[model samples]
Target: MKSLSLLNKLKDYLKPIREIIYGLTLHEMDLETKKARGNLDQLFMLVVFGDLVGLPLLPPYYSMRLLPYIIPSLERWKRSVLRERDLTDFVSTDL
Candidate 1:
């Protein structure tokens, strides 16, 4: 039928636009997922290494056991945790 052909043509014309929108949405979701993963990593590090900051919630033996798995990120986590932060630092960074 003419109507069915017109509908098919309309969908063909919009396919590129649909693909673009889907790609953009997927990209945005991926970025958000990465950010969330980073936040969780930071929190896990804080809990595991809190003793360095004098919290000492976990036993040293367990912390050492988990240390090897997180060794790559240890330096950056230490720097971020130990750095002196002012109100200006809070304002400058995306919290």
Candidate 2:
């Protein structure tokens, strides 16, 4: 019982230190990577389905071939592509 309690105490003590280390070393990189991935996904969607929004780059035959795989995110991609943005939208995310 005492050993279990000591182990619990040790874990509680180490938890914040572990989180601090992770925050200091890995958090910013993780956020940047996620941001990059989102940008890439949006760009890829634009390439694949831009016709729906009137900026057709790829030919229709290929877009039709890929339609099934892209269906789930189609609405979200359209909304994201068509939404209005301002300078503050870009500036605030960096901070």
Candidate 3:
């Protein structure tokens, strides 16, 4: 009936509103997860190829093997790691 159809239409209209509210509440959590993932990725890359910066934790051969696959992001990652940090950078936990 008509009542059931009206209920369904109302639900369809509210679906987007419900998702928006859920997204708003979880936005911060999603940002933190992304930041943590980036940090972990950097740590993994460092462990695999720390020799590039003169920290020979791993052998050069293994690092070279992985170099090609990581080359694309290597420059950006290096810049991020090597960039100078100021007091504001230390204070900012947004990342």
RMSD, every candidate, angstroms = 6.8, 2.6, 4.1
Which pairs of residues collide in candidate 2?
none
Residue-wise lDDT of candidate 2 within 7-87, one digit each (tens)?
A: 999999998999999999999899989989999999888788677667778888888888888989989988997999998
Error of 2 at 80 (Å): 1.4
The C-alpha lDDT values of all candidates are 0.82, 0.87, 0.83
lDDT tens digits by residue: candidate 3, 4-74? 99999999989899889978898789877898999998997778657777887877888888878887888
Instruction: Show where candidate 2 strays beyond 4 Å.
Output: 51-62, 92-95
Which candidate should be chosen as best, given lDDT against the real structure? 2
Q: For candidate 3, list the clashing residue pairs, or say none.
A: none
TM-score per candidate, chains pooled: 0.52, 0.76, 0.59
Residue-wise C-alpha lDDT for candidate 1, range 35-56, written one tens digit per residue:
7897799899988778667787
In Å, residue 24's CA in model 3 sits off its true spot by: 3.2
Q: Supply the TM-score for candidate 3.
A: 0.59
Could you tell me which residue pairs clash in candidate 1?
A: none
